[model samples]
Target: MPTIWLFAIVLVTGLAGFALARGRAVASAGGDTRVMHSRPLYHGLNGLLTAMLPALGLLVAWLILQPVLLDRAVVGAIPPEVLEDGAARSLVMADVRRVADGLDAAIAAGVATPEGLAALTAEDDVRGLLGQAGVALGSDVSPYVLEAARDMRATAATLRVVMWVAVLAVLAIGLGVALKRSHADYRARNFVERGVLVLLVAAASIAVLTTVGIVASMLFETVNFFSQYPASSFFFSTNWDPSFSGRGGGSELGIVPLLWGTLYISFIALLVAVPVGLLAAIYLSEFASKRMRSVAKPVIEVLAGIPTIVYGLFALITVGPLLRDAIASPLGLGNSASSVMTAGLVMGIMLIPFVSSLSDDIINAVPQAMRDGSFGLGATHAETIRQVILPAALPGIVGAVLLAASRAIGETMIVVLGAGAAAKLSLNPFEAMTTVTVKIVSQLTGDTDFASPETLVAFALGLTLFVITLGLNVLALYIVRTYREQYE
Candidate 1:
């Protein structure tokens, strides 16, 4: 709900500010920035930025700080004895909140019993007497303590309401202002077009920001994890029994077996996905009739739309046993569908659209002029496609493959269901294997204490995955840039 509110507020502010600027500028004598400095749309955008930027900063700060301030005030009210025990701090706070809420509810309901009434009366009387004694006897502390407690409670409630009101008011004010300017001379089309561009850029920036946040979060946690477990052991040790004790009575947090499993399963998935996907893409792009493409493209995309969890179930219940008897047993592999092959194959099927769709787009985007030039040179369609079109689209093809690889590496559910949870560094595709994603899921899926290496290790694995994906994306961007030059 807060998220939805935040979005609505930001959008309203942006639109309102944009509209106001456009209106004021149009009404001015020399306001046309392009006709006088820049376009009317740019003027509107400039206003939007001015209005929303500072206020949104305040909104973000308020959102982050409100909970911390409330939590601290509530915690500070607890008695000192409860704070000394490690667990008592939490327990007493819960009880104190329950008592406060019960008091509020009882007072509201008019059902407060004699004991409840007596206890509250006693507390008030003691506080009042303490206050009078503090004033009459010239003691400086008792009245102040009571006053401070009351002030804290009231202030917390006030701050909560003010924050919500501020958020809603900002939204309502912004929306009202934007609507007020939607007149005939508002130039809505130009304003909307420019806004759409900004919106797209903002959307793209979130992906970059999300990647940065993940890396930064994992970096700090990984540092903590490495402090507890030596880096060498985590990277090179052949075992990955995180529940085991270290030589120094610490937890065993080695990663060799998990890394091995990740690579094996990913390799199998790539083996299954790449050739099939590439050939299908090649055929569809170069040979398929327009009618076939119309039918096939949507069907392939539908595969991508299927949820990964569904594929996981398909692997667990249907594919595992089928492979155990049909493939594994015949090949002298273990008779289990939860082998590397089962998950890898199903995951490969999942990734086919990823590879094919991207490749198709790149291949199709290759200029028709190049195809015509090859034809004019008396080259066959196949030859022209292989030599000219593919070469021109090579960088994009590589980018697509890299993207598919990243998807395969990060996939969790299918592997979790189809691959056995054995963290062994075995080369046999028929034997069950695990992956980093699977290990991360297994480690962090339940009620886990943050202090334990078992839980912290997931952050480390996440850091590794983030780094790998980041590297791949950067490489893809570079390749795409270089390929853009070829077409240009």
Candidate 2:
């Protein structure tokens, strides 16, 4: 909370600084001057950018680098024996911190000893020797725990005081400057507008940075996975029994069965969602009256707003049993609620609004001019819509469908409840089958061994799903871009 308050202060200070710089710049020009390319506001925004950019960058760098430096200093204080024994870095670090903490408590309680006191010794021999080693091999133990703590706290507090003072100082200064210049020729509005523009751009860039970070992290993990498991086994092996094998403990990695089940359920879901959703979109966008559209569009989209857990329960209690009795049992099939069809059907119902709402928007985007042109040629309303508008809007419709397919492939709850936990490859949708998402949830939702194949397999599955969705998104983008050319 203090950090947040500090940030707010810095932001306000920067904005005010910008506003002042802008007013000064504007005022320096002759009172009758109207020669600048942009409004005075742009100048103010530019000033804000200058003040805030370097300051914010410095703050972020300090936050990231401080922890690493402190950790290194803490690690250096451990005895040579602990360091030389080749223990895992994490375990060693944990022990060092524990020992240091013990010493601090002992020192406070006046119960220190050389053996027990070995952990928190500020002895010159230890400090000097560590410093020499660190200089020789970059492994110094700067005995500055107390000093570092004091400096860090003091520096943070100083920064806070500076931030608040700066904010109030700049705002008061900027307002004074602006008010002094507030004749009929003053340009306060221009300065404010420029500030708004810069803020919007900053907001947009955050989302872009986040997306890049996610993709980069996922890509690095996938590269590690491929190095461990052969691409052939991951992509083509039909079996997924990655049991603990031997003393060496490397389990086989296969993804084909998971992929098969994923595709099968998504296929069933699309088969149900496409016709129902597209028809609904067409009716809502083209056929429905204004009153019907206002009432029904929100109502249809409301299904999408329903939580997936609720849908999962519905699948488990209602749809799963109904399918078992009405369809599967009568067909001489196994009577399991947790079948591929049960999940797919329920998922399709959940996806109806996702498809329909998007399709409606794209369909509505079709120019009324095209409809008028068709009607002028004596085409009926149904034929005009079916033959002219739908084709014209096909790219957007296809994009919507692709997005829906990605959603279906990635869905977890419905499959968890209505698709059985069996990982068998099967042709019959009525037979139980598990999906990649379900398996990932099952594998990670408990006391998982990070080194175990069962747990690590989730990462591999995640990489696969990420790649597949990426491809679908790319394809959707391509279709949308291409279709935009048709109208042009």
Candidate 3:
């Protein structure tokens, strides 16, 4: 059965269990709710929780493990001669999967029967047969792959059958247990509540685990990179050059240039965004009437809805050229359209909504009594806003600014399209520069060897960027806590 069908079956079964257990509990209590220790709804929920969570969990686990186990088996059965040229087993496994999909498609197209596919050899025109099924193959199917595809299909069919039976059995057993406990005196409410609490805790733990997993994965790759490339050179040397020369050794994998570009562009972006966005927010929150606020706020926030790539294109096609022609060329700065200034200006425009929306909300959240108290103290509207309201909302504003800073630092598309990919240490804003995020993309983009330092360095760059953003977030949190404590 399809996975979706299995999911539907489990859900329907849980609902059925809920109805049955609720009816049984009510009947046991002679249809008198006061006589039962727990309500009929709680009894129903207990049955549903028991049957649904375990069966869904089991099905998810089965789906995750099935492919891994099958891939290992298929790879193991592949002949030694298939790997004589030392092609990656992963690539071969990909081919095997594609062949299996092709076989399925061919069967569906009625071009080949299952029995005929099983009897086919490497000498057969397997690619042509697959093409008739609309699957284009780069090369002819090998004997081992053909056979392994068949074996994989057979094993997968059996596993699916077994999985279906096991999941249904688990659901039935859980429902049976819930029904046994569905009497007049049992604490079904407590059991259901506890199960829900466990589920909530599991959901929270999964988030933390996902963060740990991301950091660990990048840390492992960063360690591999440092093992091959000297950490000192990567950290201190102010040069960025990655050699894609298949032989791969003589590249000066320095990050200082990239880091400088990232910081420089972010600094320029913040310089543009902070004042404009914050002032815009202040005006919208404090000065604008309800009618104007509703119309203008959404119009300004429409910038946020525009995709980053569209901003990148705006930078590429409009902002960069205009800056180059109007300022850079006239001032005898670099003549290139793709420059740090161009990317920063465009990125700042993109980040405007992140700051304005958040700051506006935070400012609006300040107590009305604070404003009234300032007025009672014989202060004018401007003075009250400047001294009372702004100070009260400062922490959240700082947080919003830092959040925008984090976003600016992580921007890739604007930097890529607006700031050309010339990694160098230059003071001129008119010169083309690249950020760490852009360099990470460049390094990992092509078909390259992963074992090489050049490729692994992308992970190191990624980890560095992650650490920087995390520190910014921590700082934002600290600012919010400290200021809020002092004032509140």
Question: Which candidate wins on lDDT?
Answer: 3
Error of 2 at 315 (Å): 0.6
lDDT for each of the candidates? Answer: 0.73, 0.71, 0.89
lDDT for each residue of candidate 3 in 301-342, tens digit (9 for 90 to 100): 999899889999999999999999999999999789999999
Query: Alpha carbon lDDT of residue 165, candidate 3?
Result: 96
Compared with the true structure, the alpha-carbon lDDT of candidate 3 equals: 0.89
**After superposing candidate 1, which stretches have Cα over 4 Å from the reference?**
1-57, 71-155, 161-205, 244-250, 474-488
Prediction 2 global C-alpha lDDT: 0.71
Compare candidates 2 and 3 on TM-score and give the better one. Answer: 3
**RMSD vs true structure, all candidates:** 9.4, 8.7, 3.1
Q: Give the range of the ten consecutive residues with the poorest summed lDDT in model 1.
A: 135-144
Clashing pairs in 3: none
Mark the regions of model 2 whose C-alpha exceeds 4 Å error after superposition.
15-51, 65-207, 242-250, 447-454, 477-488
- Which candidate number maximizes TM-score? 3
- Two-way TM-score contest, 1 vs 2, winner: 2
lDDT accuracy of residue 22 in candidate 1: 72
Cα lDDT tens digits for candidate 1, 228-314:
778998888888776624223455667888878887878888888888888888999999999999999899989899999999999
Instruction: Quote each prediction's TM-score.
Output: 0.71, 0.71, 0.89
